[model samples]
Target: MKKYVEIAIVLIAWFALILQLIILKDSLANYFSYFTILSNLLVAISLTPKLLASATSFGKRFSLPKTKSAIALYIFIVGLVYNLVLRGIWEPKGWQLVADNLLHVVVPLAYFSYWVVFVNKISLVWKDMISWTYFPLVYLAYSLIRGYFVNWYPYPFLDVNKFGYQQVLINTFFVVLAFISIGLAMIYYNKLMTRNR
Candidate 1:
């Protein structure tokens, strides 16, 4: 059942992403544009550990377990922020609406559910929480650099041209803080679970 659900999420994400690009039409012209959006990057990020867990033992290697939980928490943040802060901006219709929800809502829930239902409770530590922050920071650095060159921001809060670097940096700082909070909470939860056992 877990494996099947993982497969479903991967399929659904790809299906929605392709359909969304098709619907956008104009955005399709810029190839690099596709990877810039956080939603696309997140679904792909969320997919990695799921795929790793089921098909191979790679997820347990190269600090992949740390990365997995971190990405899961990040995607959770993505969905939460979208639903709470950003949902009103897009007036998607029909299939676009479906795809929008799938990407923004469904995938995030599925990934979280996968973590709760499928992931073994590892005894987590402070190092795990610290390790979780690396990828997001790199992503932030990359996004800022690219935004400077291309004037294309994936999220409005991160748009330096419009919001300016100060505002965007502030937003990014909060996001990083939130990531740390979530990572700590995840570790705490795992620790509690281990204690119970």
Candidate 2:
């Protein structure tokens, strides 16, 4: 029952996000889509077996690692730098770009931090990697298709029209690499934590 509730929270959050994007299809280009994507990704990762196990007594039965939290923190930091500092989107005084970025990027990163650092207790593994990676991969594909018809993309990283297909693909490759690295780091972290405890 509790597991169902936890899963429900994740699903509901993602559903609400999708509904918002559908309704605001026009304005979704700005930054809302980015936020939705990131938020949903975080939620999905949180519901993964390794992370969920940490919250259960059974999680202690296995020799979990400690690298999950560190990786999550690293991802959050990189995301912060990418969206806020390097992108120059955190200027709260200007065109509300900062606010938009904060809602879409900052908030979700914060959630990831909380989940990885304080909530998750289980060790991650290859299976956990597959599960955690699925959501973002699907979301990225959906966003690309949607961007084609809508003539709008949620983030600059995915703006193929502007960057050209080759560039977009290259950037996407890098993004995938980053995600994979982070995922592996998270798995290691979780294992370390479990062993230490």
Candidate 3:
């Protein structure tokens, strides 16, 4: 029963993502919003066992990550601070921006929390990391092709035409660095927690 529910959530999320991608076609904002939600949803599904176990008597047996969850929590906190302090100062009434940023922070934190508390198993490997990297790379390429055809970019950091190829390349480099750093940290943290148990 639980497995079915989990599978259903995963399938529904992917279905929505695919539908949005096909329907939105040229709308960068729509594509990105759906993609982000889909990624978070997939992560949540992958970590659901940890989330459920954490609520039961076997919670302590799961041996969830301390450091990784701490980092994810901090990221959520920083995002909130950025929205309240920086974004608020720039545009006090930017409700849409606030909402969007909040969702971005919340979804990832929720996924991280579930991973640390309920899912004690970590099956990630080099192949998984490569697969994760591939999605972003492919998405970036697709975004570039779409931008070329439609003359618009989804996110400011990815807007090559506005920022130029060199700047976009620099931004991509930083993005990849950030991804690798965070991913390695999480992997190490998970391994440490599991070993200590």
Candidate 4:
């Protein structure tokens, strides 16, 4: 049952990404700029190995509890930020709409569920929570740098051209704060669950 659920998640996530890739093929660079796409890509990549019932190194590595937890944190933020901050900023239509919801809503929830139910939480620690921030920090830096060169920001709050440096930095600080807050909560949950078990 877990394998089937994971397979479904992998298929759905990849389907949404591929649909968006097909629709936005002309501006492939811009399409991949969004954190939504990248985070969903991570989820799909991390979860894909579950479908392969072989004892491969890639599968074992990604199957690590910390790896799934980190990816879960990323996709969770993608859903929260999109719905809370980015939703209604622009309306997507047709297949793009389907892709939008899948990336921002369905995939996040599904992957988090998979992590909560299937991932081993006994090894999670405060350090793991801190380490999880690396991906988002790197992504933020890459987005800001690329946007400076390309004059295109994936999300409005991070748009330095419009919000300027000070505001963007503040916004980024809050986003990181939110990430930390959730990471702490996740770590706490891990401890609690493991203790009970």
Candidate achieving the largest lDDT:
4
Where does the lowest 10-residue lDDT sum fall in candidate 2? 62-71
Q: Candidate 1, residues 69-137: lDDT per residue as tens digits?
A: 766787787787788878987798898788778877887898777777776658457787777777678
TM-score, one value per model = 0.81, 0.59, 0.59, 0.96
lDDT of 3 by residue, 115-181 (tens): 5565444654433344445555676677777777877775676778789989988976876665666
Ranking by lDDT: 4, 1, 2, 3
Lowest lDDT block of 10, candidate 4: 46-55
Model-by-model lDDT, in order?
Answer: 0.71, 0.56, 0.52, 0.89
| Steric clash pairs (candidate 1) | none
lDDT of 2 at 26: 56
Task: Give a tens-digit lDDT track for model 4, residues 1-197.
Answer: 88889889999999999988988844788887788898999988887875774378888888889988999999999999999988989998898889889999999999999889988778888998778999899989999999999888888999898889999999999999999999889989989888887
TM-score of 1: 0.81
The residue-by-residue lDDT of candidate 2 on 63-143, one tens digit each, is 133333433443454465366534663344432444345434654565465555455557445566665556567767877
Indicate which candidate wins on TM-score. 4
RMSDs, each prediction? 3.3, 7.6, 8.5, 1.3
Q: lDDT for model 3, on a 0 to 1 scale?
A: 0.52
